[model samples]
Target chain A: MTKKLNVAVVGATGAVGSKMMEKLVERNFPIETIKFLASARSAGKTIEFNGTQYKIEEATPESFEGVDVALFSAGGSVSEVLAPEAAKRGAIVIDNTSHFRMDPEVPLVVPEVNRHVLKTIPKGIIANPNCSTIQMVAALQPIREKFGLTKIIVSTYQAVSGSGIAAIEELREQSAQWEAGKNVEANVLPVKSDVKHYPIARNVIPQIDKFTDNGFTYEEMKMINETKKIMEAPGMKVAATCVRVPVVSGHSESVYIEVEQETTVQEIFEVLKAAPGITLQDDITQQLYPMPIFAENEEATFVGRIRQDLDNKKGFHLWIVSDNLLKGAALNSIQIAEALLEDNIL
Target chain B: MTKKLNVAVVGATGAVGSKMMEKLVERNFPIETIKFLASARSAGKTIEFNGTQYKIEEATPESFEGVDVALFSAGGSVSEVLAPEAAKRGAIVIDNTSHFRMDPEVPLVVPEVNRHVLKTIPKGIIANPNCSTIQMVAALQPIREKFGLTKIIVSTYQAVSGSGIAAIEELREQSAQWEAGKNVEANVLPVKSDVKHYPIARNVIPQIDKFTDNGFTYEEMKMINETKKIMEAPGMKVAATCVRVPVVSGHSESVYIEVEQETTVQEIFEVLKAAPGITLQDDITQQLYPMPIFAENEEATFVGRIRQDLDNKKGFHLWIVSDNLLKGAALNSIQIAEALLEDNIL
Candidate 1:
C-alpha cells in the first residue's frame, strides 16, 4: 500500500499556487488530506480538487499543525515568515521563492539535477529553482556530466506569465489596445512598482527584475547563482541576459556552453536524448525545433538547434524551452516532494 | 550645387523596393529622373511618390541605357540575371540582394562602417549587406576601431517584416485567429516554402532561413560572412543565431563580443556616443534602453545595456536595435549611393 500524507498549498489563489493545485491532482499524488491556504484577502475563496471543494483559509503559524508537506508558491515575504513555521511543525516545506534559495542551511533542489541533496535538509526546506533556471539546468545537467561544463552564456526569451497574473492580464489588455489602434498603458511588466514601465505589446523588454550592484538584473543573477549552486561547480563561468518577450507561457533560451572535454555534436545529441526530463527535437531537415507555443503545457524540457561552435571545438549552442509554470515553478516543487517520498526521507 | 543623376529602382513594387522609394523621397536624393521598373505582372501598376504618380514598367536590358544609378531590391535570381547587365552599362548598381554580396569584385558596404571602400567600385556593382548584418555592424564598428575586436557572438530578435509582405500579413491573420480561439495556420514564416510552418503571432521561430549542412541556417551564415566582409576582418571569430519574433518593423540583437584591449563600460559608451550613425541609450536609472516598438522607422542604430562580462575582463555585452526597413535596407542602400556620389565613384 502507498502512503497518503497531508499536504498544504500556500497562496492558493495566485498563478503559481493555482498551478500547484492542478499539478498535484494531475499527477495523482497520494494525499489523504489537502488544505488550501492563502492571504486574508483570498481566505474565503473556494478551489475544487479531485471532485471536492476546499475552502481557503488565511495561512498562519497554526495552519501547519497537521501538515506533512507544504508547497509554497507565495512571494518571498510570505515564504520568509511561513516556511520556517511550517517546517518547525514537522511539515517539510518546498519553497518556490528566492528567500531561502541561497540559505546555507536550506537545500536548493531540482529533482533532475540534484535530488540527492534532499536526503538531509538541515533547515527542513527544499528550495525550488527559478523558472528560467529550472529549464536550463535540467537540460544542461546531462551535458555537464558527459562533457564537463566550463562556461555558459545564455540569452532568454521568457514569456510574460513568469511575472505574475497581473502581468499576463496587462499583456492581454495592451495587445488588444495596440491592435485596435488605441493608446496602451503598462504598469506591471519589467518589474512592477519599479517606478518606470515599458510597453510589452509587440515589443521585448531587456529587464526582468531590479538591477543589482553588478549591473545584472536580479533575475539574471538568480540564474547565475542557482546554476553554480545546483551543479556544485563554484568555478563555472555562467553569464545570462534575461529578456521578457511577448510570449504568454513557455520560456525559450539560446544557450552557449563550452565544455572541458572535446565532444562531437552527435555525442551531445545522444546524451540529451537519454536525459531524464529532456526531449530532443533537433532535426534540421524536418524544420524540427522547440517553440514556446508548443511547450506551453509540457513537463519535459525541450532541447533543439544543437550545433558546434565555429571557432571553439569544445563549444556548442542549444535552444531549450519549457513551460515556466510547470517545470519551472509548480511541478518542480511537487517533484521535490516526490523525490523526498521516493527516497523515504519524509 | 549637387549633381543630379538619372536613377532606376528595379522591383519597385516589392516591400524593400517600396521602402526605397519612401526613403529616397524622405532623404531628398539628387535625381534628375526616377524610373520605376518591375516584372511584367506589375507593369501597369502606379505608385505615388512625392505627389507624383509613376507608372511601373517591365525592366529589360535596355532599361539601364541612360541610368547612372540603379537600386535593385529584387530577389537573388533577378539580381543574378539583370545586375550584370545594368553594371555592363554606365549605371552604378547598388544591389540589395544576396546574389553579389560574396562576389570578390563586388564591395559589400554599410556606409557607417566601410564607406571608404566606396572610393573605387571596379565592377560597378556595390552590394548592400544583409538587413540584420547592416544594423549589427553599424553598432559594432565603433567598438572595433576603439577597442580592437577579436570575437563576436550574436542572437537576433528579428521582426516579421524582414521576411517580406506575406509574412507581415500572416502574422496579422494568425494573431487574430489566436485571439478568437481558432486554429492558427502559418504559410510564410521562418522560410516560406519549408514543409513545416509555425505561427509567429506570439511565438519565436529559431530558423530564419533554410538550414545549411553545417547546422547554421542561411540567415545565420549571412551574418557571419557579411560581418567579416564589411569589417574587412576575414579571420575574426563570428557566430550568429537568427530568430524571427512577432515584431513588425525593427530588428534587435543581443550581442557579446571579446575585445583585444582592456576598456571600461563607460569608455565604450563614450566611444559609441560620438560614433556616426549610432545612438547610445544606456540609462538604467531612467529605465531607458533600445526597444523595437520605439525603434520603428528610425534612421539610427540604437545601442544600450552595455556591461562587461563577469569572468572575462575584455568581454562585453550590448543590445542593438534599428528599423529593419529604414536603417537595415532602404536607408543603407541610399546611403551607399550618396557615398558613391560624395567620393565621385559614380
Candidate 2:
C-alpha cells in the first residue's frame, strides 16, 4: 500500500481554501492526518471534515512543523508570508496564490497540460497558475501541440466568485434585491474598497481587478503572461480581455486562435475530444454547448462551439467553460498533489 | 428644406419592427405619412405613436403603393417574399432581416460607418447588418479611418430579443419562474427548434443561431462577412463567436483588434471618446464602465474598459455594448430613412 501524506490546508475558511479541503477529501488524497490553518481572526473555529472536527489554528512559521504537504489557498499576502515558512519546514508546498507564480524558482503546474513541469519542483514549493489561465491552458494545450499556435485572442465572461466570498455574497444579495424591484445598494463597484459601486445583478462589468499601467487588468495580463510561461510559448501571440459577468461560479471564455498550419474545425474538435481532462460539447444543432450552471461542481474544463473562421480556415473559435474554483483553483492544486504522490515525491 | 418622404415600418408587432416605428418617430424622419404593416394575425392591431394611433395593415405587394421608404423587420422568409414585392413598387427597402443582407446586389449599410454603400442598393434593397456587427463597425470606423484595421476578433454576449418576440417571452417567463423557484424549462437552445432545451436564466449560452455545415453558426459567420462588407475591407481578417446571454436588451462584445498603425490605450480611448455615436465609459479607477443596464435604452453604442496588450502595444482591446433592437436594427434603419430623406433619394 502507498504511504499516506500528512497534509495541511492553509486559509481553511476561505472559499477556495474550503474547496481545496473538500476536494482533497473527495478525491481521497490518502491523508494520514489533516491540519486546518487560517489567520488569527478565524482561529478557534471548528470545521468538520469526514466526521472529524478540527479547530482552525492560527497560521505561522511553525504551522507546517510536521506537515508533509501544504496547500495554500489564502490571499496572496498570507501565502507570501506563510508559504515560504511551510516550505522551509520541509513541507512540499502547493501554493494556490499568486505570490510565487512568476517566481523563476517556483514551478507553476497544470497537470493535464504541463504535468511534466512537476519534475522541476525545486526542493519544496510549487505554484498554481491563476484560475483563468489554468482552464485555458488545459483546453489549448492539445491544439497548441497539434496545430502549433501562432496567436490567441480571448475574451472572458468570468463569474463574480473569482474575486472571493464577499463578491459572491454581494452578487447574491444584489440579485435578490433587484428581483424584488428594490433599488439595490452598491458597495462593491470596480473593487470592494473602491469609491463607488454599481448594479451587477443584470449587467456585465468589463473590468476585473485593478487596471495595470499598460491598461490591461492584472487579471487579463496574467492570462497572457502565464499562458506564455506555462505553454513555454513566449513568442506566441496572446491577448486577453477579462470581464466580470453576473455568473456565480464557472468562467466562460470566447477564444479565437490562429495556428501556424491549416486546421479545420472538425479536426480541432477531434483533437479536443480525444484530449485529456476536456469534454467536447459542441452540438450547435441541439444548443448543447457549455454553460456555467452546467459546469458548476465539475472538475474538467469544458470546450464547445468549436468553429473555423469563415475568412481564414487556419483560425478557429471555441467557447470554453469550467468551474473556476475547481479546475481554476482547488481541484487543480489537489491534482498537483495527486501527481506528487503518484511520482513518490510526497 | 428637404422634402419629407412617406415611410412604412413593416412587421410592426415584432421587436425590431416595434423599435423601427419608435425610432422613425423619435428621429422625426421627415415623414409625410406613416404606415404600419404586419402579418395578417397582427394586421388589425393599433399602435400608438406620438399621440396618434395607426392601424396596422396586412403586408402585401399593394401595401407599398405610395410608400417612398420601406423598413422591413420581418423574418427572413417573410422579407424574402414581400421585400421584392414592395421594392418592385419603387419604394427604397431597408431590410433588417437576414434574407437580402449578403445578396450580391443589396447594399448592407451601417449608416454611421458606411453610408456611401447605400448608393449601390440594387434589388431596391438596403440591408442592415446584424445586431452584433452593427455596433462593432460603428466603434471600429473611427479607428479604421485614422489607423487602418487588419484584423478583428469579436465575441458577443448578445441579448435574446434579437431572436424574436417568442424569445423575449421565454426569457421573461423563465426569469419569473427561476426567481419563484419554479420549474424553468428551456424550449430554445443550441437553437429553438432543436429537440433539446436548456435553461438560460442565470446562464450563458454559447450558441446563438443554427450552426452551418462549417461548424460556425450562421450568426458568427454573418458578423465576419458583414464586417468586411460594411468596413469595405474585403481582405480584412475577422472572426466571431456569438453567444446568447440572459440579458433582455443590449448586446455586449469583447472586441480585440490589431490596427495597422501604432496605437496606445489612451490614444484609442481618446479617439473613441471623440468619435460621434460612441460613448466612452471607461474609467477603471472609479469602476465605472459601459454595462448592459446603462446601455439599455441609450441610442449610442457604449464602449469601455479600453486597454492595450502589454506584449503588443499595437494591439488594443475594448468592451462594447448597445441596444440590439435600437442601434443594431431599428435605429439604424430609421437613420437610413432620415438620410434618404435628407438626400431626396426617398
TM-score of each: 0.99, 0.94
| lDDT of candidate 2 over A303-332, digit per residue (tens) | 987877766778888889999999999999
Task: Kindly report which residue stretches of model 2 are placed more than 4 angstroms away from their true locations once superposed.
Answer: B311-313
Best candidate, DockQ:
1
Which 10 residues in a row give candidate 1 chain B its minimum summed lDDT?
A: B337-346
Candidate 1 regions with alpha-carbon error over 4 angstroms: none
lDDT at position A312, candidate 1: 94
What is residue A303's positional error in candidate 2, in angstroms?
1.8
Candidate 1: Cα lDDT at B148:
96
| Residue pairs in candidate 1 whose N, alpha carbon or C atoms collide under 3 angstroms | none
